[model samples]
Target: MLWKVFMHHSSMIFLGLCSGSGVFYSLACLKTGSCYFIEWELISINSCCVSMTLILDWMSLMFLGFVSFISSMVLYYSGEYMSGDENMNRFMYLVLGFVMSMWFLIISPNLISILLGWDGLGLVSYALVIYYQNEKSSAAGMLTALSNRIGDVAILIGISMMFIYGGWNFLFYVGDMKDSINKEILTGLVVLAAMTKSAQIPFSAWLPAAMAAPTPVSALVHSSTLVTAGVYLLIRFSPALESTISQSILLLLSGLTMFMAGLGANFEYDLKKIIALSTLSQLGVMVSILALGFSDLAFFHLLSHALFKALLFMCAGTIIHSVKEFQDIRAMGSLIYQMPLVGIFMNLANLALCGAPFLAGFYSKDMILEVAFMSSINFISFMLYFLATGLTVCYTLRLIYYSLSGDFNLGSLFNVGGEAKIMVNPMFGLGLGAIFGGAFLSWIIFPQPYMICMSMGFKTLALSVSILGGLTGYLLNMGSVNYSLNSLYFHKMTVFSGSMWFMPFLSTFGVSKLFLQSGMKYQGIGDMGWSEYYGGQGIYYMISSWSSKLQILQDSSLKVYMLSFLLWLMVLFFLVL
Candidate 1:
């Protein structure tokens, strides 16, 4: 009934519940200094039923606070931003569903309930992404859904592996199966899933695509909820992944990803794409920190990243909406005169993102870098870390300078001025949070023992180097070079390769031709093989053929009906299994 009431009056009810819950949770945290206090009781549901145990800890409380805080802000912002949209009702439903799933995910004591919440959140995010129902929106939604599903399947398999070899009880299973399961296999699968969900490396293509969704959806799902799920998984299963080899792989993969994505963002023209790549880089940093055995650093970065990234995205949204243009950055210039407050907020958020001193990102990111430095003196890892930090500074400053510093050119269009009150208000609130939230939190949230902590001098030195790199890039922009070391090398490579023609030659003729032409004998086999092997045409053929067959199968009434019933039965069986 309460849910029904919320459904009926979603904006007011959700706002009230989230606000009240956040206040309650914060007060509880203050009073107890802990988030979770577990009480276990056995209850009989049926003659043969699985026994369940409830467990709560600081981790659960931390996540609960995160969900409550972000959800409340999103809801408050959305109430005004989405006021009269036709899909507002549906959006509300999805928002509530997302919040509930996050709640369930955080509080669930066992893997099963957590998986349920995980899948639920994934589904809700997909629905919300397509709420706009445009071609780009749907495409982005499908891409995100598909990528997450791949991760979900990996997680399911890992969980099943745990059940089979590690035992069915999650907490007790860890100690029992320490020697039984293959650490390599478990770690490999978990890392794969984590990378995909967190938008790390190769699987990261989906997140920037997801920028086609509404700004609120981007802020909530991409910035706060879905991206953080993978981090939560790593922290939750830290014990299981404590082996030296697993930690090494995690560190290397995350470090490389951070460097690559940050580099990518430095050259990106789209505003949202820049932010999207930054999200990937930030997640990599968090993962790298976790791999270094600094769980506290990961958690701290998670909190700080959530606040600043969401604020940055919201500020970008305001800019895009007011200008009535998708962000190319090149098309934007000197809006500070017209949108002074928005410009100021944007600069503040960007400064935090660049790890400016005394900001939220600086505190958390410096801790991670310090841990990385102390973990190993390996030159390779150190260089990778340095490069990632430098790239972070370059891209963040690129965003700030390109969008806010150039001469005021409205382009072909006239002045659009600032955004509506609904949008501006959220920007203001998030901006304030981005600037001051970290200092306030440093005092209030950091344990008493950690309260007097200061940034390491070495870390400060590293940050100064990063600042110099960014400044050099900014100064270069004043010249007519129009290219950096990265772009120059890329241009030379393209020229040497005859502008992407050599790509096919190298991939197909040089390598794939050797495979296809040497052994195959069937008629049309060479064509199919070459297409699949060299030209990359086979994938298209396969997909088109499979889709056609699927369409035909769906059109068969008896087959369709039987398949539907079978699917229903399977779902029921799983539910009761």
Candidate 2:
């Protein structure tokens, strides 16, 4: 047990050191505008080079820093959160493996090489999701794995298509091949893969479902390692997508994703799932901006969001851990009075999520929205952007009301207090990041501030919607014990909106219902009915009956032998005469 604790602490320290080194290197690279590529040639054929390449640039290094830092905190927190489990060592190893997979992904610019990390993420996440070994966790793991498998398939096809270009290193030739049919197909595949990874639109269900994982895993997965991978990949491929049809499609889907996630989050009651949905919404924000030709902005938001979201999950973990694993918000209230530290940090993360003032989310999210407003986008994209932003605030405040402000609903006998030092320490580390990580990232990523020239209404639009959303969220939830249910009046519309526009149904049961039904039919008719009658069982029964009759005849031979011989001799004599 002591060694296990030591293991987590040691891993945390190591990752923290690596995080510092990566951040420093990233800043140096940014300052000097320098990038290093280390490549080892595997083979060359017809002027196409195949090799393992590592890209050391500001973007990759910065991401590495954020991922490592968050991972370190998560590991430290896990030491206490999962300390009682028998497989603590295995859990620690799995988390390390997950981080290593992200590391491979961050450094590699080669399309072929990137799959090592891409597929690694899917496999390792599946392992982590099912770590609890419950039926729910198993189902969630399958859904997560299968959903990501679509992206894996897309990446594989993309690699095959890139083969035609005589090299798998897309960085070397993507710009040169711009607007060509092959380039479009390759970029389209890449976009499709990113959409699935980032949980955009059609692929959004898995993100919430993946909350069956341990909270520390949730912190890492939702914040950095898994969900952001798609966004990161697109950032790398942004050059190919600029002004193309792929960009337009990605913009539409990512916008819808942002709106859908925010809307769903407002109705969701699960603590971790709400955070997971928020992660999905933020992913939408990042990708939508990427679709708008601001890869740097997307990357910047990705890093900043990672910091606060990790902190948010850790705080949620502390709360859930304190309250004996009750995830339902209806079962929780007035936690702020009991768990003051957790409530403070959780609300801090939530406010940052809402883009309040100068917090981490304010710098990137506010900039992304402002840039979206200034961009030459269609009216639909424009409304989706602002509406989604409003919904973000709506859900965040609703969360605070239910989990932090109301009367404690769990009765007086429950054990709920934030006394875990291991957990609190990580939240503090991330709290600092949540407060200033955005400004720090913005300064490093964009040395020149963006110039905004908009009308008064457009300028105040973000704040206006945010205030309205917060009011709606808070006032709407304020009700007596027997308050009338408004959602029942508009049941169908409420259900549609709350259920992510039936995407979970479409992605899960809608897609699998036919095949599942077919399998059931096959099992009934072939295995239980016709096949049993005519196949192996039927033949066995027939053979057994024949053998039984033959045995009986052999056993009765002594009595009948004399009579049979007499009859045979008479027949032979008659024939001779």
Candidate 3:
């Protein structure tokens, strides 16, 4: 126990220090306008010069700094959040292993090395997701793992394809393969891999299901480590993905994903799942922007969103912890009265999510929208973008209303105020980031401002949708105990929207339903019916009856044995006659 506590504190402090150093070095790299590419030549095969390569650029360094910082805070938060678990040591090690994988992923420009990190992430995430050892967690872990495996397979295929180019260092060849047919195929594979990892479109069901993991794990995975890996990879590979066909496809899928997630969040009641949906929504925003040919903007939002989203998850964790581990928003209300500090931070994070000016989300999210609006995107893409933005605010306000303002719902006996100092302290660090991390990153990432040439109407469109969405969301959710259930009234639509367009069913139950049914059928007829009747039970019954007759004959008296012999002789005489 003491060692577990030490692991948490020691890792937190060490990561915190590393975060600072990474940021300092990143700034130095930016100032010098230079990057360090460290290459260690491994064994040469056919003079191709296979080497372990690291890209120590400002971009990689800065991202490392942010990831390390969020990870440090998450570790400190977990020290309190996971303190009661018997296997806290395993939890600590798993989280650290996750961080290490992200590190390998960030620095490696070689596809071969990237696979090491990529597979590590998928495996460790499965471990973390199933940490509770419950049926739900196991199912969720399976979904998460299998979904990410698609990306892993895509990466493996890409590696195999890259071998034709003499090496797996895709960074060296992405630019040169622009017009090559193989390059297009490789880019498609990379996009597919990114889509699966980032949980876009048809592959999105796992993101929300993954909420079954512990809250701290949710914070780390959703914010910095797992989901963002895909976006980060795209940012690194942006130069190669500039084809119009790829961009258009990415835009469409990501837009739909953004809209779907935001719509789903409004209907969701589980606090953690709602946050998970929000993460999905934001991931959509990142990928959509990346598809629009602004990888830097995508990268910018990635960092800024990480800050507040991590904070958001932490706040949600504190609430879940306090409410006797019940995650339903319907079970929690007027928490502001009991846990004022948490309420403040939670509301702060929510508002940031709404892109209420100047917060971390605002700086990145608002800009992304403006840039999208300004771009030459099709009508469908444009409408999806704005609709999704509106839905984001809709859910955010709805969450605040249900969880913060309404009546106090906890029982009178429950004492659900005053969070642990450890939990609250980590929130403070993230809270500061949620407030100003955007502006800070904006200045650092973009030395020059993005020039906007839009009219006044276009400028206010984002704010307009946000306000409209919030009002609509709040009013729709406002009701007394006698309020009619919207879900019951509009069952079909509710089920469709609330279930992410039946994606979970399709991804999990739908995909496996046939096989599961077959197994049940086989169990009933093959194993329990025919196989048992004829194979095991039939033979047993036959043997048992025969042995009983044999025992009876063996135990028979002399008269009975003599009568049986006479009866057999009489039958033989009759047959002879």
Best by lDDT: 3
Report how far residue 280 has shifted in candidate 3, in Å: 0.4
**Going through the candidates in order, what is the number of backbone clashes in each?**
0, 0, 0
Cα lDDT tens digits for candidate 3, 445-505: 8889999899999999999999999998888888632387756878899889999999999
Q: The CA-based lDDT of model 1 is what?
A: 0.70
For all predicted structures, in order, the TM-scores are 0.77, 0.89, 0.89
List model 1 lDDT by residue over 1-577, tens digit each.
Answer: 3443244345544555664565466656666766443434344333322333344554566556556666666665666566657666677778878877877766665655567678997898888878878987897787788778888888777766665543334555544445434656666677778777887655666777778767777887755688888887777666667764767878887887788777667667788888888888899899988887777678778877888888787778778876766588877777787788878878888888878888888877776777677665478778888888887887787777777886554578656674667566666656766777667655555656332333566647667768886986576554512345455657754353222223224432454467555656542666556655656676777788999988977786897888889999999999999
Candidate 2 similarity to native, TM-score? 0.89
- Distance (Å) between predicted and true CA of 152, model 3? 0.7
Error of 2 at 173 (Å): 1.6
Off by over 4 Å in 1: 1-56, 164-169, 175-177, 443-445, 448-457, 480-489, 492-577
Q: RMSD in angstroms, all models?
A: 13.5, 5.6, 7.4
Which candidate do you rate higher for lDDT, 2 or 3? 3
Index of the highest-TM-score prediction: 2
Kindly provide the TM-score of model 1 when superposed on the true structure, using C-alpha atoms.
0.77
How would you encode candidate 2's per-residue C-alpha lDDT over 429-544 as one tens digit per residue? Answer: 89999898888878877888899999999888999999999998888888632378878888898899889899878877987887788888899999988999899999999999
Rank order (by lDDT, best first)? 3, 2, 1
The count of residue-pair clashes in candidate 1 stands at 0
